[model samples]
Target: MFSLPIIALLVAGAQAAVLTLQSPRFTVSSSTGSQLRSEPISLAHASSIPVTLTKDDVLKLTFQVIDKESGKGVQPHQTFLRFYDQNSGEEGIQPIRVTNGGKAKFELNMARPPLSLPPTSDAPLQVSLLIGSSTYSPLALSLFDLIVPASHPVPAHPDEASFHPLPEIHHTFRPEQKLPPRPISALACIAVLAPWIVLLGLWGQVAPRAVHLFSPGIFPFILTLGAFESLLVWYWVDLKLGQVLSYGGVLALVTIFTGKQALSKIGDRRVGRK
Candidate 1:
């Protein structure tokens, strides 16, 4: 049978989706600089991209701007970024002005939306940029439509300690570049997951409080997930298993709360059930 943690993870994870956004490329000439040098910048790197994060997940958005003229970095005067809910027609996420090395580095952290309250599914959020008081329109709206459906739970404040990294994006960006290889011995994984699996099983046998299982404490959950990923990193194995297991653990908690009602449906089929 699948462990409770694994089940919980899968249940929440299955709701996640990939989101991407691209801005438009523009050439800002001094109108009469030296040698008339031109710089190259990608629309993909300049705009705020939509990201789905579960509570306590930390997200960092990096934008690199290169100057072609002096073969150096180009810094803009002031960079303003905004996050808007396309569905609600309201601004959702906002950040203070970003200055990269005293210039427009074009990179900023996409702070997660406030979650002191509940999240509404009515609106889809998007990021935007303001350079020198001019609103630079993004390329095609279709370009920046990355939407990871399941995000980490929002915290009272936006800080790294309260964030979890996204494994899917990590894998996508570094293709075929497995941080760690598969464990030579499955025993190691079994050993690691044993305790939680047992707890999950026991919970299944004696179901617990529903609220305790699904409470809004995404930080601890994400921290635990990060620890699992860190273990995989140390073991020199791909973290895919850990990622799935992370969510699986959560799902298991959910199952335990539901009196194992979903067990019968999941009994015969599980992604990596043993």
Candidate 2:
């Protein structure tokens, strides 16, 4: 069997350990640099009284991350402080950077609160600590409840378009076109068919005396002309213009060669008779 990679084995070992916070503490101070309340955070339960911060007040937090199996401090991959409001269901997460020795400190000033701080209200915000490391199980501990001033009203949504009555729609359309009567349409059809009808009617009279017309050289020329006429009729009925044009071009070449041959044969026969 293949063995796991060294990095994978190392991560597995780390995950088997247990992670915990040591010396977790917080201090509330005034803007004039006087401490208001200072105490070590309890890991077992939340404090009876809620921590409150007015405008311009500051809150400082300090802690050390360590593996429970080994008392030595250890830095974890992720360390965050979460503030949540149960009533509004709004929460914010602020990342805290830990040193190589696992010591961490965070400062939250109400005058310049971090953007991660969510909109607040009269309700107390639940504060908690979250720690995660590749070498150990993740740890989360509820720290305390906090109260802050009510936030301003939420502004209008930037992506929403203005809603108002729109101007009445005025549509302009082309007038209906009138078509010709059936008798006129039939007359037009006759106008197109008259030449074909007259020529076909005269073909029988001309064919009997035209001995050269059915000959090999002239017959091909006549057939090519018929192909061109058929292609025109096919285009008018079903064939596309491009297809008819392609077939016509090829037929034109054949017609040119055949017509030249037929005319040359006629000229030779005339010379011989002379």
Q: How does candidate 2 fare on TM-score?
A: 0.52
Predict model 2's lDDT versus the native.
Answer: 0.87
The TM-scores, one per candidate, come to 0.27, 0.52
The global C-alpha lDDT for each of the candidates, from Candidate 1 onward, is: 0.43, 0.87
Model 2 pairs whose backbones collide: 14-135, 14-136, 15-135
Q: Give the per-residue Cα lDDT of candidate 1 at 223.
A: 47
Over the stretch 1-274, how does candidate 1's per-residue lDDT look in tens digits?
5569887767655543212222223222222332222233345453343344433333334443333233343344434455555664545433323344323323221244443212344345555554432222122222133232434444545566448673454334645655454674576788888899889999999987654334334334544556556655754664476765766677557545443444433453455462
lDDT of 1: 0.43
**Per-residue lDDT of 271 in model 1:** 50
> In model 1, where do residues sit more than 4 Å from their true spots?
1-50, 66-68, 92-97, 100-120, 133-143, 146-274
Cα distance off (Å), candidate 2, residue 61 = 0.4
Winning candidate number (lDDT): 2
All-Cα superposition RMSD per candidate: 40.0, 16.5
Best by TM-score: 2
